[model samples]
Target chain A: MIHFLLKGVLHDRHRSLLPLIVITLGVALTVLGHAWVNGVLGESFVMSAHFSTGHLKAMTRAYAEEQDQMPIDLALIGVKEIMDELAGIGEVDWAPRIRFGGLIDFPDESGSTRSQGPATGFAVDLLTPGSKEIDRFNLTSSILSGHIPTREEEALITYDFAEKFHIQPGDRFTFFGSTMEGSMAFGNFIVAGTVRFGAEALDHGAILIDLTAGQRMLGMPDAAGEILGFFNNNRYDQKEAQAIADSFNARRSGSTDEFAPLMVTMRDQEGMAQLFDYTHIISAILITAFVLAMSVVLWNTGLIGGLRRYGEFGVRLALGEEKSHIYRTLIYEALLIGLIGSVIGTVVGLALALYLQVVGLDMGDAMRASTMMMPSVIRTQVTATDFWIGFIPGLFSMTLGNALSGLGIYKRSTAHLFKELEA
Target chain B: MENKQIIDINNLVKRFPIGDGYFTALQGITLRFVAGEFAGLVGPSGSGKTTLLNLIGSLDSPSEGSVVVLGHEVSRLSHRESAALRNYHIGFIFQTYNLLPVFSVYDNVEFPLLLQKRDAVGRRKAVMEALDWVGLSHKAQSRPAQLSGGECQRVSIARAMVKRPELVLADEPSANLDAKNSHHIIQTMKRLNRELGTTFLFATHDEKVMGYLDRIISLDDGRVARDERPLCVNEAQSDSTAEENGHARRQARI
Candidate 1:
């Protein structure tokens, strides 16, 4: 029986090839869609974990609220002592960050004295000695190009900003801002080697400067926003960290009224978490649509062809073939079709995913700047799991379509042979 | 347990609904055929020969009577049981040789064996022998479409005999064949019957088929009109009858 069914399918190979191809491609696409979403999320998570936050992060609520406040300035004098105290505790690894927001002026290269828009700058203590957090955060390479700031003046601008302003390793740039004493202040720093992080938003706007200089420039002396910590293992209790933060807040009872509210800990970095959530929703919608469309296509192709084979079924029945045998044979044919289609589709989809990973999707520069808040080149990362994930939807669609078609074939009455033959 | 009757029909009747009314296809047909008999059912179109064949073949149930084939009450059988009984015990040859298009000639012949529990080696031997008997062993590997109409009919005959059934019912077996193919198919079937002692019942309208039958049952308006033994009895019986008639004629002359 199986032999006959197989021979029948092969005999009609020409007729079945079109549907098989269509079904296989559909399955592959389904797999690819799932893989794409997973790859994007997984890659983003790894980048965020490596460059911004480890598995867990701790920061003051005040630093989280006031984006411009330097975390080192908000730190109490005893904050480092407390951090050291916590560091000795089991699995506690701390990295203190001094965050500051400033602006980068892209010098006009047209010889015109026209003012250009200021690119946003973010300064962090990325090169502290023996700091595992800083080491992890430096995803690309060393922070500054020429050297670490011997004085509180040197800065490292992002690759995007440096490219925009034609700044190099030895070039000096002046920064002017109000001091903490309400007096005008200015300084100059040598340009450092630029670091390239793949993320468009990070590459385009961020600049690194000396934490002490940022503290002085922000006019927050001996005050810091919050201390950032990464645990060796993500076993530290958020409640415990919050409790310590609250105690610090209590000790600073007479602080300025404008002091930002302090927070304790968060799991994921802010930018990464937002991007992941957004992409997840989009991926889900795309996958659902793709699956639905593929299922419909498969159903249409399989069922229509199956129904058309009724005359053949009738003839078999007339020759004393059992209806069960007929049903089994048709289902076997469908299974073969599904198997072939799924294999082809999986291969095609995986290849497409790999290609996409290699040569990333580049939205034009203006659109990239407007939508992504980063550079134009955004490459998708391919993962092994992505291929497997992409393969499933296609395989499922093929099976489902073929099963439904088989049912339609089974529903046909064998007694119709007389009338069918007469026609 | 050694019964002679191969088919037993008791007041079998068949009616079909046409539009809002009923059309009687067969009106109380009661007939029987013993084993090893070659019988022909002759009728014009719409004359109930097919209805009677359908009932006897267990393809359909009688409206109001019993049809027993090979000691089993066919009307009482379930659809699956009927199909099984037909596959194992009764061989059916249709007006159009219904060979599966996907199957080769040998596979088509071996189709009935698949329903049984025969192993592949046994099935192959049986199919090869049947095809040999039909003189189509050379065309065994050819598909049905590749064969001529006559050759296809021969393949169907092989399929029917491969199961070694007790009764073979051929419904207009040569309806689609040329005269030559029809004669060849009839000769092949007759040979099979003689060699295997399988009872054959044919429902056909062909006059050319009448000359080849051992018995003819003419049907008209859903009833048997004439049941005649067209073949001579044994030579012994014929000689005795001739002697008795000659002596009576001499006495009359005296």
Candidate 2:
């Protein structure tokens, strides 16, 4: 029965070819869309974990509410001892961030100072720099055009910000802020090399100053606002990480009164997970629509062809062929069609992915600069999983079309068949 | 066995709807035919001969009464059972010589055997013998479109008989052919019928077909008008044996 069905399909090759091509193309697009989403999310997760947040982050409860609402005084009270305790935990790689939010004052070309409209800046401890952890922050091959800040007198600014402020390496700039004692302080720092983090937002808005310099300017001593941890690989397992963080908080409640009120871990600081979910939903919708459209086209073509074969079906029935036999033959034909379509679709999808990956997707320079801190290329990457995703949809469409065509055989009656023969 | 009836119909009726009113295609037909007979069902166009033949062939069910063929009530059988009965015991020849255009003449003849679970060797012997009976063995490799009208009809005949069915129902088997092709097909069918002792039931309007049959059943408006058996060439020469048999049957009845 299968052999006969196959022979029939092959005998009508010209008629079946069009629908097969349409279904294959539909499946290919579906695969490419899913691959694109996976590529984006995977790259984003790596960037966030390695460079920005690590597997988890710990910050003051008030600072966790919102960055702007964070109190500058929260770090000065007993947080240093808590950081030491967390670092003592064998599974943790903790880094302290002495970050300050301030505006950079740009010197105009005429040598007159001008406001740079509240440009954000961060100050880190360069002495204890975690080179392995920090290497992930390198988005491009260029070495940021400057040296890291080594003293209170030296600072590093992002290249985009440096260009905007008319500042150069070795130039001096003034920083002003109130101390923790409620007194004003001012200092001048020589410009170090500018860094290009590749991220448009970070590149245009950030200035990096030495940690102690920022501490003196902000008037807080021996305190940092947050501790970022890179847990051992096992600790970073999503379920185990949440459980460990919760247990740690519970233990702190029994051990110390001051640590009880502190926020242990911040989950919302990791936007990468949310981005993954959002892209996946979009990809699913797009792929479904593509498959549905292809199914409709294939079904329509098959239906028309099957209807034209009604006379042949009628003759078979008159010759004592059962309805089941007719149906089985048609279904066999459909399966063969689907198999061919899936193979072609898989090849086409892989080819498309390779082509795009080579040429790259142009998301424009501004968007690239903005998200450059993330490592995924904007182009699609071809993978084995992508081929499967494309192939299944085509197989489904062909099966559905074949089932619909088989129904036409049941519409005929044996008595009417003899009438057709007489005609 | 000599008195057994191969086909029996009682009060058979077939009605169809036409423009909100009912039309009677066959109204209470009652008839029977015995085995070893070449019978003609003759009528003008729309005279209901084809309708009666369809009922006898088990291709349709009679609306009112019983259609019994070969000791089984056809209308009582399930659809699948009826199809099976047809495949096993009945053969059909159509006026259009309905051969599968895709298949060669040999494959077409081999088709009915496929419905059975016979192995390849048995199938090959049966198909070749049937083709040889129809005098079409030489054209076995040609497709239907490549054959002449008479050859195509011969192929249809071979496909029908390859299974060695008990009954063969032909519907206007020569309607598409010229006089020469029609005569050629009729002669081939008659030769196979005599040699194999198979029952043939033909529904046709052609007068040429009526002359060759041993029995003629004329139908008008779905009713049997006349049943007649004519003498064959051999029977006409053996007058003493026929009369002696008739006298013995009458004497035994008395």
Candidate 3:
């Protein structure tokens, strides 16, 4: 019976051709859709982890509350000691950064402040060979001007800021801001280079300086606003990272120090939590819609095929083939179609995803005016789920399609069919 | 009905609903058929021969009376039970030689045995033997579309006899064939009947088919009009009594 059915399907080009084509195209779209959704959401998360937030961040409660204000007085003290503990954990890599804002003064040969403008400064450990800051900013790819700062008092400014000030490498500048003690503090530095952050908000009036220079200028020893910890696995899964943060904080819940540091995962950050939640809901709705539409089309295909074979079905019934057996065989034939089609579709979809990942689609032109932290080229992110996600809709929709359509056969009486055969 | 009969029909009446009224296709069809008997319900169109054959095969239930084959009432059989009856005991042949177009001759012959869940070896042996009986063993691999009308009817006969069924019901088995093929098919069925002692019941208006039957149950206007049994092949072939009855039939028709 199986051999008979298989031969019938494979040899009957007229009946099988359209269903196979529909199944193949439907499965291909299903595979591609899953990969695209997983790619967009997964890449968005990793991008956020690398630039705006680490997998987890630790800071004093007061510092966290006033983090938007860049309050140096509320910054974590003994930053090296806290970072040492975080770094000892196998899954964690810690980086200390001082996010502060101040006025940058361009000095003439007279050593006086000639022109000044408000600038945001990120003081990071750039001298370390494997430092997280360099990778996080992807600074190597953004060097539009000279170079990243190698000297203690050298700074890397944004191309916009440099153009605004007509600044050049080796040009002298003075950074002036209030110290943690509310007293006067200032430092002079040479411009090292200019760079673009690939984000409109970050590329304007931004400067990068070494950590030691900022500490000296702030007049606050061993102080950083926060210690960012990245998970070594690089997935930065929010739920897992949040659980780890909760565990870490619980261990220090009895600490009497009012300024004690607390841990927060990436999900705790503003503007990101809602985005994460919406990603799942939107992907589910989109996937459901696609599956339903494809399944319905396949169902119609099965129904039309069944109608075309009405005589064959009637003959089978006359030959004493049970109704259930006929229905089951119909579904089995559908499964064969789905199995072949899904393999073809998955291969094509995976090929497309690989192409996008390796040779990313450049969105630079569209992104120039955008303030979001996403990179211009949005590459597909293939998770383990993408490997077999297509079968859910491919096999199921077709199986369900044929099964639903075959139900009409049961409704037809064998007597009626046998009589119809007489016609 | 005789106690030793393989199939017994008692007061069977079949009606098909047409619009608001019922069209009586069979009325009070009462008959008993014994083992090894080659019988045919001989009649013209609208004589309810096919309807009575359907009841005897358990493919359908009688509207008024009981059709008991092998002691199980056809009217009382569940769908599965009716299917099982056909699967194990009864085999059917159709007018158009309805060979499953997708299957080869061997598969078509092997179909009834497959329903009986016969092992591969057993099915192959039985199918080959039936095809040999029909003298189409050389065309075992050929599909129905690849065969001539005579060959297709021979395959249909092979399919019906492959399982060694106790009762074989044929509805106009020679209707689609020419005189040569029709004679050839009936001779093959007659040989199988004599050699295997399988009871045969045919629903046909074709005189060539009636010429081979050992027993003839003539029907007219949905009722049994005559019952006769020719003692030998010569008597069955001559069938002068049936020819005289045909005159009566025409008179009844007028």
Q: Which one wins by TM-score: 1 or 3?
A: 3
The predicted structure with the larger DockQ, 2 or 3, is 2
State the TM-score of candidate 3 restricted to chain B: 0.90
Model 1 DockQ, alpha carbons vs. true complex = 0.32
Give the lowest summed-lDDT range of ten residues in model 3 chain A: A306-315
| CAPRI-style docking class of model 3 based on DockQ | acceptable
Scored by lDDT, model 3 comes in at 0.80
Give the lDDT of residue B174 in candidate 3.
Answer: 90
**Per-residue accuracy of model 2 over B1-254 as CA lDDT, tens digit each:** 14468898899898877999988888878888787677888877777877877788787888899999998898888778877878888888988888888778987888777777668899989999999998989998888989999899999999999998888999889788886677778777777777777788999877566556667787888777777775542323233443343355346549
Q: What lDDT does each candidate get?
A: 0.66, 0.69, 0.80
lDDT of 3 by residue, B1-254 (tens): 12268988889889989999999999898888898888999888989988888778776777898889988998898878878888878888889887878778988888778777889999999999999999999999998999999999999888988888888999999999997788788878877887888888999887777768878899999999999885544323433454444445456559
* Per-residue accuracy of model 2 over A328-406 as CA lDDT, tens digit each: 7766666677778778877887788777766656453637446445542466766677867765556765666667766
For model 1 the interface RMSD, in Å, equals 2.3
Fnat values, candidates in order:
0.35, 0.45, 0.29
- lDDT tens readout by residue for model 1, A1-423: 677556767777533677777876787777667666656665555555544554444444444554434433334344455566556544556554455444444333463433333444444564466645445545345343455444556666667677677677766666655454556545566665576555665676566665566666666554444455555654335566556545645755566644433434433346645665676687778767777777777767767766666666655555566767766766666667776777787788778877877676665454535433333444455566555553344445555655666564446433444446545
Worst 10 residues of 1 chain B by lDDT: B233-242
